[model samples]
Target: MSEERDTAPSGAAAPPGAAPEIALPERVDVFDTTLRDGSQFEGISLSVDDKLRIAEQLDYLGVAWIEGGFPQANPKDAEFFRRAAAGELKLDTSRLVAFGSTRKPGGVTDSDATLTTLLDAGTETLCIVGKGSAWQVRKTLNTTLDEGRAMTSDSVRYLKAAGRRVFFDVEHCFDGYKEDPDFTLSVIEAAALAGADCVVLCDTKGGSLPHEVQAITAEIAHRFDGLQLGIHTQDDTGCAVANAVAAVLSGATQVQGTINGYGERTGNADLITVIPNLTLKLGVGTLPEGRLERLGPVSRHVAELVNLPLDPAAPYVGTSAFAHKGGLHTSALRRAGTAAYEHVDPALVGNHSRVLVSDLGGRTGMSMKAEELGVDLDAGEAATLNDTLKGLEADGWVFEAADASLELLMASAAGWEQPYFRTEAYRVSGYHRADPNQPGQGAHLSTEATVKVWVGDERIAAVGEGNGPVNALDAALRTALGRHYPHLERIHLTDFKVRVLDGGAATGAVTRVLIDSTDGDETWTTIGVSPNVIEASWMALVDSLVFGLKRFEG
Candidate 1:
């Protein structure tokens, strides 16, 4: 294996006489199904606007094709295509492809509602899925083998004759080919003979292994010398990405997957992972030149539009992908270089390396983290902070996921005190009482909190009421500090999570609270721990406010 000069994290010069670059494929088509198959993930429901925005992001990332949803199946998908045709959606690099199923078993292509709706979508490219497994034709669709072959051929033929590029998805092709190669090959042959532009082999059940996919794909490629081949795999067996890559190595020119691997069941292959692997690892050109660096930002943007938190540990684009926390790893990274701990240059995929400070990290990690946060820490200060971090972690305080709190701690250790208000005391109380409006229905609960604080020399007391203690405390704290720091109004707590550390203690268990806050411009996390859940929450909440004030006021 050859190593490229790692220039991202440290900006160090490359070693002399590095190995020469390996020869690689020029390009591979990236077909994104995030809007169609990705929508099938549980709890995902995209509106027309969301679909349109996601498409724009994908196009911006420069994928070859974006699979818009099945228009005939839903009004939202229909409106998506209609709006795209009316100039609501614009594309610069990616060509939008409409997704649908082939005509029904006995239906004619010209009169089939599915076919007509696909045509109405007005996309130059159309992808239609059909039964590729003998079992599916015999049992699932309850149709004869001849009808199944006809469905695949007729749909492609109709779309081709109508002046559209057609791709036929051979659903369950892996399993079908394994069970009966002749039958599956016949189905593929039918579609190819009907003028399909490409034949996509799908691991519909997501159970195919990498070796199996490669062998089968090689056979298909050999059989169809001139036709383009595509690979689509799911993650049920956790091999979706591996299978896709294996197929590509065998002969597939196109990869059909979704961003972040969002799909039904486990997920489709993640283009977020696959794209980087193809470009950086295999040296295959998947995206347009220079567009590969947009992968991380595009993945995150789409996740936000879908209202899902992108997995921090996801390969390549995840937040934690290049994060270093272990003492040995951080030491090596600091002394040696980024190549000591990282596989590829994170900048290549639009992500940066992160140094996390925690009990598991050493002074080097702490100093690196402080530098990243723009805080100057001497060796002595970093050593002291590392000791303090371990002591706090022993008491159930976690700082790895709470950067804001960690930064505040480092600043305090560095003799930089926050000029914000100091808390004197706080009190919270809750009550449940019968409501006269709904007699005997249930007890209505209410919480109230009072906070006393000093901005400079003057002390202020404020009281607030809400449905919960945290809310009431936030309201009270805001009431007390809003006038002194107007920027507090912009910092809102977006999410809160509580974890019980000493579960064996039951009611007396120590609790860890993580609070996510946003000030419209950026988001930060803070953490606190205490035996009293309320106190834990209060600690995190206060850190959140102080951090925001420091950023906004200073």
Candidate 2:
């Protein structure tokens, strides 16, 4: 291989030993593997519908390419491609790419099932992974080195000849390069010779460091001049993002990653973190201009679509990424701006600064937080509120996760009253009945609730039945208020979480209930705590209703 020097683009940070900047191309493709690789995460199971929805989200986020799924893997994946082929799944800026492995051992190119599935996926682009390490090809696949090379070369040649843009993923390239330096380079040479449009060197095991990635990438970039190069790294060593950056610095033109770093094992490199670093920090162009700001919301949207909770500490997108809970940090942040305690402006990624109310918050922090929460507060009142909040925290009230509750508390302290409806009383009962005929169905549980509320002096009582006590209460409350506050129909409880504050008390423990409600346009979380779980749940339920009515009606 030639010893050509490779460096970063002009004004971009140079690699460790590059003499001249390796000028970046006009645009680097941001390929998203969220739908395919993201499903590899434990507890993540996506139906065919989920795959299509995730692809649409990735395209909306301005990804250049979306690896839909492995078409040959299962019926769901194949159906996804079938729907995509029929133009059922629409995309804006992203081209859907089909992912698969190269031709099987001793399989004819014309008759290979995997290759046929790739062609039938109806995607203009296809990404096929092939064993790159000589040891993997020889031992894992039980094939000779020449046959392994032929598998990759033939697959690429066949796909390219069919007019499909083929990108070959050299799986375990770093490990291969370490074991047999010459054979690894030969694998890439075979792909380029076979007319592969782009060659992606994949750190499949994700064990390569930044220095090792840069050194090997420098060599590959120098040797492969005709083909566009890319980097696909995993996160086992926690260097996936760093390795990806190193690869780009060494002249790679494309980056492949999953949103929120969702993939197998430790997961893939996080495109949410990588795009900002590449475009904002490295000055390399990716996505559309100004798309970086939508990253935070996009990350959250993906998590929600997959039914996975967002990691609040996730870089750039997490709720706590720009949240300040300390008095000193909040005070300095307000005085010196976000740069005081943050590396980048939170708004740059569509995230905003948050000052959490806690024992650590001082009067200044409380005043600033009050302003954010739309609660008018003078310095004296802020001091009082700060002291009151500390006292509440000490009493087991967590205001951080209950913003609606905190807002209501602040409004009440500021003499603002929300007298939508007055609840007089409520009663609930549960009964368990055994099924005599259907023994396999177990016991049948039933609940009934009765609620009475006064609206402008007119008291009304309503009875409702449901599967559980909380559900029955919600139904009864809604029934009682349906005629008076018809807008309550629009509000529904989306999530309900319960936590026992005193576990030692066991059956008699004090419990906290957090109720999340949404009224089409917005959502709010309200909390309540009490020794009786029913009482706690009712408090939160009523608060959620009041918060929704106040926002939507008033």
Candidate 3:
């Protein structure tokens, strides 16, 4: 919603009184570095295990190269490469790449400790980078521009002479080129002249515009031949992926990025987006050329592995890619398949389509959702549902990402049976931390829940303690009916989200919580809305656990 819908396949939407022109390059390469850079986002951190899972997913999605992490940063990064060397990875065509800056201003590549760390991490291909500007050479490294250029070429040459595949990451290459095109061009020439496998132009500042990226990358492609070229764009303008695609148009064969667009500052471009653009949009081979459908699943799998929230706005593979929200958009998409608000069917990337229900929904929206749910209802049902939805929204309910709870409500309204565990004045004891020295950690939360339930003539009362109040309540409920459902072991809460519907002058505001849970086979999302965060979470938690229990029983 931030930007307008602009990318048209035929370039037919060009501004009035303007001629359409083909600007995108014919072929491109996709290099995914989500492990290295995407993890640099605010509140984003990926462990070694996270990196390994991402690498495998990227390989499956057809990324040409996986830039593992900064090997010299910490012990975790170093272990990532070591494990990759021990064959702990599952890549098909994607190669594991280790990244580090050049040895030093005047130090030898082999002698530098960081370079040794990069080598020790155990990657076949090494990315040796250096400062790309005269200003950085003098300010950051306190070295002459000539020495910096020498370091660039010398490190690349040293890696190659040592029989390693060396890719030169020209840091600040775009900004430096803008500052002094001749100088930037010379630095890249040094890497090419020194036999580096590929020269990656880095937009370190991430301030380069798309048009500027096109001309500069084209110049580099034109200037350097017989050597592969790559692009490493940052996300300052939220255009890192777009700039990478533009660079491809300028003839860069390889593109580097992180999975899910993880990285420093705003983050790196997403390989998930870039690779498809490479293969499907720009007509280039990224991986082996037939694993395109795995794109969505792989990207999401990595997100789960890293414990990072899947960004709904992520290009090509986000939850919102094929999701319908607005009334007009949903009706059109129903008839014309994504020709309304989307350019591609998300299923092509292993992502399921979604129709979001909100306050703005109309008759068409309700009808579509009912049909998707196999509910053969007429306009009266829609009108009734609309009134019900409006009433719930007024009470701060959100059903967009909370499918399970919404279904239960609909079924209940249609005269479904009452819940098995009818509440009988349940109470949760307030929790007190067990102190820092105790085994529990990170703001300790202990919960004891008391519950009473009845099944026909049999009645039960149980108490349970868990890591949190919600968990404890669910545990007590399950214990009360342990005989009815024994296979309720794997049901778990995967992710939780809370959003305030109205944060007005009121001291306590209305909040909505979304819970994502998975059993053995598929995952489901449920939601609860309330003025109290804890209450909302409990509502979602109960729905998830009870829904799974009912499904198992059936």
Candidate 4:
């Protein structure tokens, strides 16, 4: 195991008579189980390619272990390891770990199919999830507690004998500890005596509170003075991150979690949140120097690969992690920087501070947002625009989530004009066609759009088709503009969101649309609002094009 005695920063000496400092370990291993545990989430389904991509990202983030997948469970996972062994996927800083259960009760360790599959998976590290709860032993496994302990021992011993480093995950450990402390300790003792490199306490039920986790982990740490301890927690009670941190404080040297908290039920402890908390808040170390800033990109990249929408409110790497909206908060931020409203410097995690404009914000927020977008506006103009924004928001226009649209509004007030083209007219239609091959077949629906715009006295017309009205409109608009400005080719609509202004009005209510666009290098958001969904989408789409042209084409 790697070890370094923590010391004060260079050139700083301890004061005379100061108490001897408790030495902190320089590194805490981060074991990411996103591919194994995270894929168990109801909506999550990662292809082999997706899993490989995420594993690479985790390595880039400098996690200590990438729990690739369960090799014995599925063909996809088995194929992933096969490819990994064939050198299709390579990791620089992280060790690939193969996860599987311990040998079956009353089974021979060498003959266990799952154990053999794990060895064949070609990972230097092996993680065995053994039965830890005595109740589970009798009730679920239908076996005696001694057999459970023997399963744990034989598996660890056999794997260790094969020259593979083994980590024993004591599944349902916290509950087992609560019910029978001696039995739980005996299970851990079995793994340790069998030469396991690490023993991870798994809060499988995810119901343990932080205090309970700390006390149990403390006792385990005290009892096993020389064994490396790890923690794995689920978030059913919304305390996974807290419990993981508590376990670390009580002497855990490794953390096991999924990125973005992706897992079954409520998810596991989010390593994205755990990394910063361990290193920045608790003054311990994980990952490597200067890799913390990749947290945002890594989190978002995994979400993108898994086809999961990134949660904007996720802690640390979330979009709103460092955003300020209220006028009071903006005012304080403008005067005192982010420290006035945010707990940490956002840039520390590759995220930037964002000042949002909304009904809750006044002129101060407008000025702050305008300054951020590099729009030149006097105080009087800012105040006027702030009032204008409030009136628009009252009319169901939301600017907080659509910074690009807000910028366009402010710039238009400051005498900016659309340089590319002026929208003359546009129309969208949806139709259905019967399948010709099958009798009485259901109609296949499709959307088409026609757009016309005038650029320097020349009118451009285009038609496009897509799976949806908004997509068809976007395609038509881009077709019209792409001929005149080739730069339009770089802009792609990444995300579109729609929300009804008032649920009481139901179908007749106005809708608010937020469109996110990116030009390969940068992303911006625009908003539109109207009673008509098509009109709302059109407004946001046009604003997105204009913003992209202004920012990137210029």
All candidates' lDDT scores?
0.92, 0.88, 0.78, 0.90
TM-scores for all candidates: the values are: 0.94, 0.91, 0.86, 0.91
Clashes of each: 0, 2, 10, 0
lDDT of 3 by residue, 385-453 (tens): 878997897897878777788777665555566455665657788676666676656566688988887
Model 3 regions more than 4 Å off? 1-27, 70-74, 108-122, 418-421, 428-448, 465-469, 494-515, 530-542
Best first by lDDT, ranked: 1, 4, 2, 3
lDDT of 3: 0.78
Per-residue accuracy of model 4 over 338-394 as CA lDDT, tens digit each: 667666667779888888888898788888788888888899998889888889989
Q: What's the lDDT for residue 224 in model 2?
A: 81
Error of 4 at 164 (Å): 1.6
Off by over 4 Å in 1: 1-24
lDDT score for residue 529 of model 3: 85
Q: Which stretches of candidate 4 lie over 4 Å from their true place?
A: 1-24, 428-439, 444-452, 459-472, 475-482
TM-score of 3: 0.86
Q: Would you list the clashing residue pairs of candidate 3? A: 25-249, 31-255, 33-257, 33-258, 34-258, 34-259, 37-262, 37-263, 38-262, 38-263
Model 2: lDDT equals 0.88
Give candidate 2's root-mean-square deviation (CA, Å): 6.0
The model with the greatest lDDT is 1
Worst 10 residues of 2 by lDDT: 1-10
